[model samples]
Target chain A: MDLDMVKYLAELGKLEFSDEELVKTANEMTDIIDLMDTVKEIDITYDALKDNHNAYLNDLREDVPAPSMETAKVLQNAVNTNNCFVVPKVVEQSLSKGVVIKWTYLQ
Target chain B: MDVSSMTIRDMRTALDERKISATELEGEYIANIKKYDDKLQSYITVTEELAMKQAEQAQKLIDDGKAMPLTGIPMAIKDNICTEGVKTTCASKMLENFVPVYNATVMEKLESQNIIMLGKTSMDEFAMGGSTQTSAFAKTKNPYDLNCVPGGSSGGSAAAVAGGLAPAALGSDTGGSIRQPSAFCGVTGIKPTYSRVSRYGLVAFASSLDQIGPIAKNSYDCAMILNAICGYDPHDGTSAKVNVPDFTEKLGQSVKGVKIALPKEFFGEGIDSEIKSAVLKAADEYKAMGAEIIECEMPSLKYAVPAYYLLACAEAASNLSRYDGIKYGHRTANAGSYEELIIKSRSEGFGDEVKRRILLGNYALSSGYYDAYYRKALALRQLIREEYAAIFEKCDVILTPTTPTVAYTPEMTSDPVQMYQADICTVTVNIAGLPAVSTTCGYNANGMPIGMSVIGKKFDEATVLQVSDAFEQGFTPVMPKL
Candidate 1:
């Protein structure tokens, strides 16, 4: 469990933890990984994953456009919304050599 | 009968006879909450207005001779179940202000019966831990002993039922959340077979493993609530198409010739001696009732803990990825980029246990480790399920301790692995997608309740409840001194 691996995992999960917390997490995860090693001993193959033994088969319903919640109710919990949830600008204006590059192509 | 102490059966009868108005019962529960919740802290939000309105509607229904089984019976919903126009916080700051616009299928069914919801109860944040101490809002103490934790993540539901705050409650069990708390609180709870109840609006912790069930004063009350809630729904893809039986049909029936399997693995090392003895005593009681108790072996169960955690965390990571502060839930105040915003929101919003699971989930699904951890665990899960299927061929129900020990002090929160081990006796039922019930067997010397579980085959909840109800025959509920 490298410290850098923990950092990479946090980034992947869209989570952030302090260095001290990450150290603790790495230690704990190492122990869990060790515990999980026992699973490798079970002589099971990939074909077993397909046999889910559950009654919930792929009973696909008709592809019909159904009514959904009202837009007003959907936007009720938005932190920042005018007509939609506000997010940080995806493609920002990059400044290069005292000149701003307007990314018109992306827009 | 004490209004707060009455079960759903008792309340329904009383309401039918016009001995009590629905409003009065609601008031009684509210009064009980006011008196005892200061110590138990079972509720996160109390819906007084909604309860009153529902009670009024229920009274009118009763007056018109159209009362359903659960009409006017007050319930405390585990915070994970979505309630329309009510805060379904999952006991985490990430959804501290989150309110769903639609009701969970269970809640909608209960609403059709005019059941009154008292409030949302406390749980482990995102239903991740065994102790209620993981809740970001408040630590729900066991009603039996204020210092000890009520087993969770349905601790609040159990504590409220045991403490006489609400007659019954709905609790979700991913891995023993409902049963463990019921055992610790000296009450009765049932976790139906997966897909027996719809999971349409349950805030998903682990999609395949989670099932919503009832925690109540007695097995009969639990069955009554189950009758009201269980059914197939078009909205839930995994909802079963089988007919929901009247779960209370076999109550008080003789257990003659019923063969119960006592898995040797559950009583092995690491189980508390007292819990082991109590479960054995319960087995003897069953024998006295003419039920056969056979010793069985489930070698694959040894891998249950790791397998459950791996699958649950993997599904949790994927199921919870939707909460990136875009549409609902807590969002960060400011950010210069979408990635930074998601990072900051998750960092600030989720509690420590949630972050740990997410990180571990990512690690399990990471490129190099996926084959070693996630895939193997999945295969192992099937093996565990197959082992149970084989055992059920010989036994009608499998008997075990609901938890390895009774309620412990909240100090167990310090060690995550130790906390996870608390679920060892119970998680296999979830893995097998079997119906199991945890009911009071006896009490530990410290006065904390000990529970024993009856696990039945898939969609065989009737047998599970019958066994539990018969086993609970002479055992009276132990009320907290609060």
Candidate 2:
């Protein structure tokens, strides 16, 4: 896996990893990839794979418009619901903090 | 009479016959809870007033001949399940005060059936750990030996039934939460086929594998609870559309021609020698009763722990994002910015194990390595599921030890990896999205309980229960008291 791709993905997830953390995550990623590569060697019967690997699609009914909660009704439950859920905009820095801690543990 | 000793099916029968009132049953469980809960730490909060109130209301409906299947039977609900207008803490400090505005879909189903709610049982924080030791408040101890863990993250639900707090309880299974705890505490629990029970209102933890199930004294009681909760829900798109059976009615069928498979992966090196003997003894009993026992070969099953941890925690990292200081939970009074508030609230709110998991999940799904780790893990997960699907064609149900070992004392908390391996025999069922049940088979040399796992075809809970009920009724060894 490429570091650029890792950085880009981490950024997309809004998790900021320190340079040191990035180096470590990259190595760990390589290790896991190696394991997956090893496991990937097992030969799966094509018939079994085709039979069991189909994606499930939900059976949907025709859409009918239904009244949802009124703005005020929804706001009543929020600590600060604006017309929708009210909140202070999340700062980019804080967003990364949650993600950063996660990567730290992975490393 | 000790309400805890009577099975829910029998209790429901008596309540329905007017031989005993719903109110009378509620009082008995409450009395036992008061007597035993402190020693076991099985509950975070007891709702005696609320429960008695519901019991009285159920009795009025019964008087009008309006009782449902679970009407008047008291139940201990794992705290993680949302109960509208009441706290659903998930045993985490983050949402210690946040009560949902609506009941979880399972709770709604139970309310419709008029079941008496005893209280919220204790659990690992956010249903994250093997032992209830990771809960924000306090750990739930095993009923048989107070020094050992009751197994977790649904430990309290297991302990409650075992210690006679309540006859049955609702528990969530995400990577063996229900089965392991039930086994540790010497009770029976079933993790229904994924999406067989609705996940709406269950605070998500790997939405793909989470299931709502029951822990009971016996398989019959487990079937009784399943009758009330299993069915489709529009709220959970993945919920099965198959017809829910008359569970109690279908039980006691012969097991002569049914094929049961024992996964080769389940009997390997990680298994304790003593626990291994108990499990083989269960298989032998099934053999004597004329069922064919064969080995299930699934080479990919060993990856279950890593795969489950990755998928579950990754979802958990995102799901728990809502519990910031700005939400209705523990908020930091001091912070440098909106961001600092989140980090501080989270850092302070989550215990070490919880933090460890969130971090691991975050790491597994981190951008650059998503396909290499999380997604790849998912593909392997599918492989494991395929393995089960293939084997199910040859067998009616699969059987294995629920956990690789018996109860672990609190000392194992220091070694996370060793403690985690305890769920080795169980998590694959969750990973494969299959319905499975765990019933006590025997006890180890020291008398710690051992459990047997019975995995069934998707949405085919009936076969699993039929075989389990046969063993639970007469053939299997009763778990010796710890």
Candidate 3:
């Protein structure tokens, strides 16, 4: 892994790191990826892969609505108004087209 | 009453005979925590008032002759497990102030049996690291040697139990989190098979690998805790439908004619000579008791660490995506837009190790690399499971060192890959989703504890505990002076 790859990963992961941290993270990620590459030594083919271990398909409960945590209790832990969590505005109106458009500041 | 060395059974007898009141017993433990916790740094939050209130109720239950085995027993809980109205931080700044609205299924069961929870213990942040130094709050010291670490991410729970802050504590193991710490602290711990215990309330680190288990002074005490906590829960989809057996049923049973396998890979390079010899010595002890010892080869063991890290980190990336700074946890104060808010909040809130895993997970799941990393890890996991299955066809249990070496000072693990390599001995048990118990087998030349694991087949915790208890009967555990 290189600095550019680390930066791309950080972007995908929604994280930010300083220049120094980025360099350190690149080196560490390279080492860890090297370690993970040992899995290539396994002799199994991709076509032979099957999900037969540790799967508990039969234990899943019925898909039905049941009693749930009250909205007031669930919202109590966050910044909320009217029992709904609050977040920064992420949409805007395009005045010429009179249509909602993605916020340019998102990236 | 000299409660420092008392097990859960011994405490139960004392409470039943009216030799000590539950309130007084709780007070003694609280006092001990106050005296020793300043240096040990084991507890993140001490629920003294909650413990006393529970103790009073337990006293009433005992007075009414309705006491159960765990009644009035004070124990510490890992901070990762949710307790209603208590801060359930996974030792990270992200959830430092987060409290649960409801109890974990295990906590509800323990409450029904009238056990008092002393406090929440520290852990490695998001259960990511082998050493507890990654925790944002406190650094837990090993009770045996104050300068060394107590293995983590269940470090505080192990230190609390070893340092007498509480008799026993509940810890979650994703990959050796419970047993490794217990080994380093000279205590006993068991990692039940996947789905053996409910995972509804555990702060998700790795969904497929996580299981909650008990760490205590002995295997019998661990079995008692397991009896209360192990059962099917509708809330956890992965919980097994298998019947929960009395784990203590086979404690005194003979190991005659039982075949125990020693995987040759586990004793190969990277393991300390002292740890290997101590584990071999325990195998000899089991042999003397009429059990058969067989040597075996598990070639897939070489690939376990890589597979475990790739799979665990990938799942962790998915599970932790819920913390987008909208619902709960630390939120950045100076963000002008939603995208910036999430980026700044996550970057500021999470520690270094957590960030590394998250990045690694994302990289593994990315388009081009997914086939080479994540998919291959899944295939390797299946192979590892089949290897264990073939071995179990002939052997009843497998014995190996719990960790490669004894606990070391934080300076010894400055390189991250070197630290991950130390988990070679214990990670395969989680990879195979089997049950294993770790107990102190011997001490090193410096008097530090060395632990050996007895691994059994899936859903066979009864046999695992039976073999562990048989070994514990012959070994006398040494504790550090407070």
Q: Best lDDT goes to which candidate? A: 3
lDDT ranking, high to low: 3, 1, 2
* Tens-digit per-residue lDDT, A1-107, candidate 1: 77898899888889888888889888987776677677777777545545755536444567899787777787888887766566776655663333322234222
Candidate 2 has an fnat equal to 0.09
Q: What is the lDDT of residue A53 in candidate 1?
A: 59
lDDT by residue (B191-284, candidate 3, tens digit) is 9999889998999999889999999999999999999999889999889888999999999899999999999999999899999999999999
Stretches of candidate 1 exceeding 4 Å from the true structure: A49-52, A94-107
Local lDDT at B391 for model 1:
88
TM-score of each: 0.96, 0.87, 0.96
Give the runs in model 3 whose Cα sits over 4 Å from its true position: A46-49, A53-55, A80-82, A93-107
The pairs that clash in candidate 1 are none
lDDT of 2 by residue, B1-482 (tens): 65666888788789888888999999988988887777889999899999999999999999999888888889999998989877888898877877777789899999998889999999998898889998887599998788899999899999999988888999999999999999898999999888778888897777777899999998888988898888878777777677888877768877887899987878888788877788788788888889999887878877776677777778887887776765367766666555666667676777666654565567677766576667766777778877887888888888888887788888887655555556678788888888889998888777778888898998888899888887887744443232
At residue B352, candidate 3 shows an lDDT of 90
